[model samples]
Target: MQLEIISRLPSTKSTKPPILCIHGAYNRAWCWDKYFLPYFAQAGYPAYALSLRGHGNSAGANRLYWASLADYVHDVAQVSQNLAQPPILIGHSMGGMIVQKYWEAHHSHPAAILMASVPPCGLWSPSIYLACQDPELLWQLNLIQFFGLRFVTPSLLKKALFSEPTTAEIIQNYLAQLQPESQRVILDMLWLDLPTLHSQPTSPLLVLGAANDKVFPQFLVNWTAKIYDTQAHIFPNMAHTMMLEPAWQKVADYILSWLQERKL
Candidate 1:
């Protein structure tokens, strides 16, 4: 399968392992291009982001709705295999869950970072949490899943993604790039496909979350960290889409520091 792999390299090559970023549902590799790819690369780490099958410029759009979580995992594996060296995986939201499954299968990555990722228990807890905490946002997201961008508005999109003030223009730009994600993959995350905790990877792990994240709340982030036996870091006043927020550099810098400390 043809995949879109967007890359950025530092002017002076370093021995740092390449960083492969995985985007979440409704987003593609371009989501990382705006901030993460360049930021990581500038810090002397080669950075790349892949548009999962049916997302961004990747192939299989016609079969997107039928794509399963396993298919997404395979896509990650395929990209990882072709890299010159094993990559340090960084995943956001649903993409974080994909990283977990990929690590479970291979267990060879240098490290893994989960940013506002779905919990290993799956989406049930967060789904129920959203239903109770902010039913309107949940309803709006459901509408977008079946109805697409027409159901999204600047205010609602901001509520779901950004806790910091963001201009309507930026919100609209992201809206234009948004696309329908696979229903099959959604179901897989909901119940069918989840990480196997019996054998965990020994690679260093970083679990990050936003205090204002409505989708995957701080509790879920804590749960994910607990399952992985690591501490969770919840940034104050941030939301689900940290990479696109006004304070995106804060998140990027934190990750860079973590990587440097581990010397990965």
Candidate 2:
């Protein structure tokens, strides 16, 4: 199982900050394309997005059997340790959770941003089902994963996760990028040991939430940050797919600003 890293560094010495973007469960590294990688690169921060083992072009590892979450964390660890400077670690959904685990294991100066993704508390609680604001969503979840002929349909996952704040084309594009089993494995990790991961200390954390998101509830994002004594910013116009939100560039701005503030 070879790791496929979309490593992008700045061309000029002046653009020296490095950022590592990690995507969520059931998703490939391309999820960051709508925002993180390119935006951060333009912000004078070089960025890298890696397709975890069993994900995207990185699949083919037997080690990815849902137990690979730790391996995913180590992926970040390896990059973080080897980088000349501690990179700004930004994760969406499962990627955010992995960043947390990495910080817990390393305790370094790397900053982190969680955008409409996972928080200190991983999704799966009854509250999230309620926050989904869709009464029949839970029922549909099981049906899609098992019964539906189009089990891996991006349209369905997009509908379950996004609240119409993202465009159909964007959803379709992202769906095309997914490597299914990798997505399943990471979600399973969130369900099992999320609380322990949440207990770990984090650096200047930014919890970005989409008020309209159907998957990760706004309350969970807010609460997760506060519980860890960090700050959060909510976007009423965004959906669960914060990276694909119409004004996804706004997310990039906020993150770059946060990184700047930390430097100040």
Could you report the Cα RMSD, in angstroms, for every candidate shown? 1.0, 2.9
Instruction: Enumerate residue pairs that collide in model 1.
Output: none
lDDT for model 2: 0.69
lDDT of 1 by residue, 61-104 (tens): 99999999899999999999998899999999999999988876
Write one digit per residue (lDDT tens) for candidate 2, span 209-229. 887767777777887788768
Quote the positional error of residue 85 for candidate 2 in Å.
2.0
User: CA lDDT of 186 in candidate 2?
Assistant: 41
Off by over 4 Å in 2: 59-63, 126-128, 144-149, 152-155, 163-165, 182-191, 197-202
Candidate 2 displacement at residue 183 in angstroms: 8.4
Candidates' C-alpha lDDT: 0.91, 0.69
> What's the distance in Å from true for residue 134, model 2?
2.1
TM-score for each predicted model, relative to the true structure? 0.98, 0.86
